[model samples]
Target: MGKITISQKGSRTIYRVNRRIVCYRDGHKYCVGKPSSGSTNIEFDALSENIAHERCIEICERRIYADMKYQNPVAYNAHKVLNALA
Candidate 1:
């Protein structure tokens, strides 16, 4: 049920979810696309590849949670409450 993938794109390594580019590596730096409407991207220079991948996953999950909150506020709050109880 997961749709994430990592692959090389010429000199840069790219991370994607469902074919949409989410993060990338260029030279010695890893870059993750912001989950907002801003035009800026996050870059990590000292992180390992695995860490960068995890960051990408975190950002993607945040975006999904934001969408869920916007589309169904009641369900989102219920889910949050359930998680908090656990």
Candidate 2:
């Protein structure tokens, strides 16, 4: 069974895979975290849909940021998340 799904609402793309939720809102530069449990707030782990795997690109950037340095964390993280989809 597939746990992933994509939806559109007024030019927004919503992604849901199991307990994780990712939303690319209109005019938003990056992925913003929203409460998948539908309570109040969401945790950091929910973001990126878990691209933190050892072979994932997210891990690459994270390591680079630690070694070299990162200029923009928001855009950097977003790029990693979106890149995994690509």
Candidate 3:
């Protein structure tokens, strides 16, 4: 994970993570980070930068977890079972 940053691209103010544009913030309307393949971009109104970043992180984590579960269900289940046992 990388730090979220605010940068200016022409007249647009966008958020980046490790040089990758993740979110676009224009006034009160905030666009969440890039979604996984086949998913549409998420947009919301009236959000602060911190709130947007938090949302972005949450989305990213969900995508990662979903991908992991799909790609390696055995490992994912094992991890979950271990966590439950712990």
Between candidates 2 and 3, the TM-score winner: 3
Between prediction 1 and prediction 2, the one with superior lDDT is: 1
lDDT at position 28, candidate 1: 39
Give the per-residue lDDT digits (tens) of candidate 1, residues 1-86. Answer: 55776777454566655324545433233354334434333442223344556765666667778989999999999989999999
Worst 10 residues of 3 by lDDT: 40-49
Per-residue accuracy of model 3 over 1-86 as CA lDDT, tens digit each: 98777766543466656424545433323454343434433442223334555665566666667888999999989978997999
- Minimum summed lDDT over a 10-residue window in model 1 is located at 39-48
At residue 76, candidate 2 shows an lDDT of 70
Q: What is the lDDT of residue 84 in candidate 1?
A: 100
* Deviation of model 1 at 11, angstroms: 22
Candidate no. 1 TM-score: 0.48
As a whole number from 0 to 100, the lDDT of residue 57 in candidate 2 is: 39
Please list the residue runs of candidate 3 whose C-alpha ends up more than 4 Å from where it truly belongs after superposition: 1-13, 16-47, 81-86
In order of appearance, the predictions have TM-scores of 0.48, 0.30, 0.43
Candidate 3, pairs of clashing residues: none
Candidate 2's error at 40, in angstroms? 16
Best by TM-score: 1
For 5-60, candidate 2 gives per-residue lDDT tens digits of 77665545667666544555433323433435564434544444343222233444
- Model 3 TM: 0.43
